[model samples]
Target: MNISRRQMLILLPAAAVAWKSVLAGTPESSPNYKMSEHWWSMLIDISKCIGCGNCVRACQTENDVPDGYFRTWVERYHVSDENMTNPEVISPDGGKEGFPEAKEDGGKYFYVPKLCNQCADSPCTQVCPVGATFVTPDGAVLVDQTYCLGCAYCVQACPYGCRYIHPQKKVVDKCTLCYHRITKGLTTACCEACPTGARQLADLKNPNDPIHAFLKTHSVQVLKPQMATGAKVFYNDLDGSVR
Candidate 1:
């Protein structure tokens, strides 16, 4: 069969359009395409944590956490089911000093680290009238210091009490998950400094990521599920009563 030059010319543009359409339909080319199915979340194994405080110090030095405020903190919960009145909650003056010596009291106790919950439906982002707080492409919730008014509404709305107004910058600030470091292919200071490997940062987008596998193998819980913030932080072996 002989094809004329005119017929070949007529077919070229249609072929180009078809090719373009196929490319446009792909997930990578779509404007709203998200590479990961879920946002990053952290899981802390309280049983494995020894309260070394190395994580806290690393966060301070790495992120420049201010003297009076913390980007992350830790709390100790002492529980006595036998005596409801004797239940006590304790946190060291600062995560700076790490956890105190464990007491020999006749009760069960554990230490839990706290940081920005980084909720998918974050109240801080909702209440920010100026659009200063926003989620990044990688799903990290962050506050743009330049856009912040320092109104502290975000500080007030955070359920985990993670957000705080920077005393020197006079802007709202909190754990950024060490955004700068993460973007550089490095782990957060806290994660890197954790002596026992209790704190781990995992990418939820990749199914092969350890966090996705962990979430599948174990049951995890978020803080204040009743609030429906869709918190991304996860706790393994968490006590139901402890918030």
Candidate 2:
């Protein structure tokens, strides 16, 4: 059938409106879209951490981390000498809540929280034979348990020894950056649970966010720079001697 010029004109406007409506309804059109660039990271201030283990408990409750496995943990480092030749790195009982009071000792003590670095060139993604491990558009590293073959390639590929195979589920699991929470317009459990506000969750893509400003104002460094993973997590006022 042949359409008249007038009929074609009428259909064109309707089609344009429909297309515009669809685009406008998408998340990309929302103000939050600009903040979703797949490069989410975190900055931890060593001085602000109180070793309270609030973040640890919050992660377990929020993500249901297995009893034996932890999505995140804190490490205690002690450096006695200015030469920095000898240092002690110890993690006592995974920093679970109700930890015993610090023993009487003569050394400097500080806690460093550790989690998935969520690298841009993530080794987990490269080692996943089934493509189960992938980086999200917003820079969050995730594992698709559905597609996982129970292989521990990712577990081994990680340099920081962060990833682990869940004992009960028999699947690899690690920190997800609270994907559900962030998508729902909420901060990460660890960030929310932090009493000192040392841990923060912000969109790196949003220049208006404090994180963006912090990155610009202060010098930050990722863990294991030689690995060249382009890690998303940054540490402010980090001691270069500590790995």
Candidate 3:
């Protein structure tokens, strides 16, 4: 059908406006997301941590993590110059409550928050016989609880003591870096609760992310570099005795 130029101009603008309205009212479909384009990481400022346990509690509350187990925790490290290799580490009750007063000792004390490294070459995933535990395209290591064999192989394979078999779920569980929240463009619960800004969720693939600037200016290190799991969590001013 042919239309007059005057009629075509009026209809074209109205149709374009309606199309934009429909798009604005609808959320983007997840199937269209290309998760492979993102690589995730976390940055820990050891100097800023105060062992407040806010992060620990937030993680448990957000994930419903089991008691006497931790997807994340904090440890107080006491290192004496006389024995740098044997730093005393303590995290009573997984540090869900803050620590008590200091004891009489001549040493330096600091807090170190621990969580999943979300390793690129994670041992936990390699040891899963059923492939129940796997990494997402966005770089989170997750377990399919329905498929997990309830074996502790993933726990054993983890060098950083980050994995555990859930007592009730009967499946391997660990930190997913709050994949549910991050995918929706929100930060992790732990990072959100960290009062001192000690924890930061980072997208290494994003050039504009502040983590890129932090890395360039700071001397950062990951736990047990020798294992070479391609651990992604980075710590700033990490003590030499840290394992």
Candidate 4:
């Protein structure tokens, strides 16, 4: 059956649109997800983190993050009894590989995973001249790489040092909480890869979500609460020495 010229024209444009969607990284929409019905967040239990670098490796692989850059990472802290306020912190290769044996024995050692806080009043969004950075209604901060100017204003404005200029793409990049996955009713790669269940994806709007119960019973804290960014990542058993 041969198609007429008018029919071919219409089919060509429709096929182009379909191909564009296939090339796009994130889906236009998920069939079952309602953005308004969910407020996404993450919960990190410091006590449960073994600093094995599973989260880091998983994030890099899932997101195709460039080498020497991280969408999510881990830092190991050593707080000596002598000086509690000034802890030694280090993240070798974004903690993609597990840390070496600790030389110092007397200090308290703990691991702290870090990512984009997905702030409610994000300074990064405020600084983006082109409005490339914005927060979704469901509480995830994302960058529209197509519109990003690569001015690095958002990178400087971020207090948590989460954003980075993509070396190849020439656009600002950061953690999206695995937007593609979360919007599809799946957990973030970091949360899924955590062996000890140290990381948990949360839906604040869900009545049955464990985050509500956990928040009530646990003494949780957000990083740099004084900044008051309304960060969604909640840390349980966080140390005072953590910056």
Candidate 5:
């Protein structure tokens, strides 16, 4: 009665689902929060970002993320006049303490913050063998660590290299968009910490939300658009050189 790895992977989801059903009474952090009434997303204004690293520090403190790994990070891109398509990107210590001064000053330098896109058609959610990764009703992607197999299938499926295996918990981990705070009617730690208002929490479902106005007037793009993951995070003033 032995099963190969491939067969076992196919079988694990059933067991995980059954186990989850038994413990289905997991209480919501904010019981009054209505998932149907909102859609969560983020807007990153590349022009406003100063590479201050406040967002990175705030995310780590609020989420208690591991020292070396990052749930949210900032990358500095140096695009030269000769190489408009190829940019030199760097993120030292996940840009937690800011970046060093650029040695070559001829090119345009800017900071791009990275995090979980919380895609509507996330590959991670579809590939989770244990049914641990899933999208919420309000357009957030989350992982049930208790049921996670730490198999890294979702990690491999992610096009943006956002997901990671936790060092101690042995579960796949990534940004939850500060789900706890958001459901409680608060903004994400990173967005709140950004001094220049570089990061903004957006709710597409809310007509009055400023994001609607911003989206109407500005040109925006998502990372790796070719993957067609239905990414929720939008970048404003994104340069063509960004990868």
Candidate 6:
């Protein structure tokens, strides 16, 4: 009850240091997360999508995406009978407000959700001038903001328009597939928010994963297969007009 002034000063400094560490969030959030032993992928079943935009909203809320930028987006396709190969693609405001009524109803309308494909041979990572972007062992391509030069090489190299320069951070940013949640054995925000079950997170390394069954049965294709990026996002019933 009777502490000297020197003792109080020392104890106060120690307490302040401990409080700062907690506020800084320096402790590893997930101690058990392993970079190996898992490869992440996403499955978008076109047949199941309803163009609700719930996925878009959830991703923004989870990732704190800036206005006019998107880590993931949904596009509505209008494929006419005569031109199935050249469907009209539109995503008004990244479909963040959901699609408007089809102005003209002459074609088959479907929704396609897009995100980083986690490509095994990702061009984005290849062209990063500072090696800021890299593919993790588990197949997720991630950016190291601290090392990034904001040179926009990765943005230009990406064929899918996935990477964007963060306005505030000045770093190239893209979808991490909710890596924080995945390593803790949870699905992505978009997947969780999808009301139609259109989006499914897949672990390719897991033998018991439903992705194996889906791939075996469904006619699926990755976007820009000609690029030969080994894209992990498989779309069921992907249209020819998608680019």
Count of clashing pairs, candidate 6:
0
- TM-score per model over all chains: 0.81, 0.81, 0.86, 0.87, 0.87, 0.85
- Clashing pairs for predicted structure model 4, backbone only: none
Q: Give the alpha carbon lDDT tens digit for every residue of 41-156 in model 5.
A: 99999999999999999999999899988999999999988887889899999899999987766879999999999999999999998789999999999999999999999999
Residue by residue across 37-80, what tens digits does model 3's lDDT show?
Answer: 78999999999999999999999999999889999999999997
Q: Write the per-residue lDDT of candidate 6 for residues 1-243, one digit (tens) a residue.
A: 998999999999999999998977633456777777798999999999998889889999999999889999999988887887888889998899998887656778889999999999999999877788999999899998899999998899989999899999988888999987888677999999999889999999989999999999989999999999999999998877778
Q: Once all C-alphas are superposed, what RMSD does model 5 give against the true structure?
A: 16.2
TM-score of 3: 0.86
Find the candidate with the highest TM-score and give its number.
Answer: 4
Estimate, for each residue in 89-149, the C-alpha lDDT of model 1 and write its tens digit.
Answer: 7767555686667767787887788888778889889999999998776778899999999
Model 4, CA-based lDDT: 0.94
Q: Pick out the ten consecutive residues of candidate 3 with the lowest summed lDDT.
A: 25-34
lDDT of each: 0.80, 0.81, 0.91, 0.94, 0.93, 0.90
Q: Which stretches of candidate 5 lie over 4 Å from their true place?
A: 1-29
Residue-pair clashes per prediction, in order, are: 1, 4, 0, 0, 0, 0
Higher-lDDT candidate among 1 and 4? Answer: 4
Runs in model 1 lying further than 4 Å from the true structure: 1-38, 84-86
Clashing residue pairs, backbone N/CA/C < 3 A, model 5? none
The TM-score that candidate 4 achieves is 0.87
User: Model 3 has how many clashing residue pairs?
Assistant: 0
Clashing pairs in 2: 38-137, 38-138, 38-139, 39-138
Per-residue error (Å), model 1, residue 59? 0.7
